[model samples]
Target: MTTAVAAPFRFFSLRVVRTRRLGPSLVRVTFAGADLAHFHSHGHDQSLSLFLPAQGRTEPVVPIELGDGWWQGWRELPDDVRAVMRSYTLRALRRNPDEIDIDFALHGIGPGAATPPGPASRWAARARAGDPVVLLGPAVADNRAIRFRPPEDTDLVLVWGDETAVPAATAILEALPAGTRARAWLEVPHAGDVQDVAAGPDVEITWLTGGRGALAEIRAARLPRCERPYVWIAGESGRVRELRRHFVQERGTDRRRVTFVGYWRRGLTEEQLRAAGE
Candidate 1:
């Protein structure tokens, strides 16, 4: 029996042992290591920092010399640049030999904000198994954040989010009490993006598209919700925040019952939103 080790900084360094493309927009990386054996699973809304290779395979530094000025450039990067860590959620974890699965939503490919090198972005493009990486959290999400909690008893849970936010929502639904009422709205970018998401019963799942009509179409008809039901929602800040206010203020639902969180703000990166959330 391996005793649990208190992780330093609530984060652990693990190696990517396997990679499976779950969907067109999702990459599931299975992480394993003794360090991760004691990994704490707080909730589905877990936010973790993932460090990709500092350099890509094409330009990977040889001889592995760190203090020889090769790493100086990155070390001296500005705050915004230095804070390039990617924020992700834990999709699943197992403790036999200790393993966890993290889902990464691949939105797009772009050059680094301050450099054209795009080491991290490009690194993700070709990421594979057996690569060593760093994971920096299991930090408990804010209780106020939407869908982060499961009530003892309740009405149906209403969860909604785009591809980027669905991982957290789906994980929450999986942890809900059996037979709990629940409903979900998944805004997948592509039809293929809705590959294998599973949630508990009492959930009316709806998938939307960005190219279609605005969410107002959905919200307008949802003027009324079931009784004693807590609505757990997350997505773009604009949409999730709107529904949050609607349920709490407009519809007169108790604030404590509903968990509303804007996982990502529009026109902002996950890192930025996480930083601001801090």
Candidate 2:
């Protein structure tokens, strides 16, 4: 008898203007704003929420100087501590009206050792070009049967994940829809999270070694050049529920053309909504 879990989307504000290092642990933090066109993002693996202050930082166009009455005490936080935000993924979304871009995935200490910094990698390692950041979210990824619109006569695409789902697997291979033909499985944490994944049409980049899972050696050698295909996996939830039960009940495929997302749940945090028994 429970069913009220709505309201978790709200945003506008980011000024970190720049911060690079696409590999060795992913940073990329460019942003600006004219309310960033009231923020509307719907790219692959989209999810956001920044709200990072407490540093002498300033400028995603300046907005975090709260103190005297501080917006009426943050409108009284207590919808479960106003839902402790910090769930990333929106690797990119543009609108030069002001500007915006974001990408972050860092996890520290050996096993591909790189992501050192802290406090969200020292606010993305002292992001300098501009500053301010506290944008909310683009949320919406209940995975709605793979959330359509990449079906431009597609027949093959099976992107796997890790390293917190490789920035939505390189923003779904840079929005693969025009001449879509996929095959990217990155299970990184090392080998510099294997770069140069700027794809578009007929992509087939596979890099896995985040620990022996190239999706069981690409399903024991080969079989998906398309027999009518569509598969989009995301990082660890027991290896995306064992490749959605080995490609929908053992290679039968067609469970609405497959799109399994599990952003995280290896050692558990939100634990992929408690293993989907949510």
The candidate that achieves the highest TM-score relative to the unseen native structure: 1
* lDDT scores in order: 0.61, 0.62
Residues 1-278 of candidate 1: C-alpha lDDT, one tens digit per residue: 12212333244556778777766666677888777754666677776656654432322221113323423554465543342456666687787878888776665632122333234445555666667666655433342222366576666676666766777877877777777777677776566667555655565677775444335645564633566767777767788778778778776778898776665676666555655763
lDDT of 1: 0.61
Residue 237's lDDT in candidate 1: 74
Residue-level lDDT for 225 in candidate 1: 56
Structure candidate 1, residue pairs in collision: 146-259, 155-229, 156-181, 182-203
- Position 274, candidate 2: lDDT: 43
Q: Give the TM-score of candidate 1.
A: 0.75
Cα deviation of 37, candidate 2, in Å = 8.1
- What shift in Å separates residue 162 of candidate 1 from its native position after superposition? 1.5
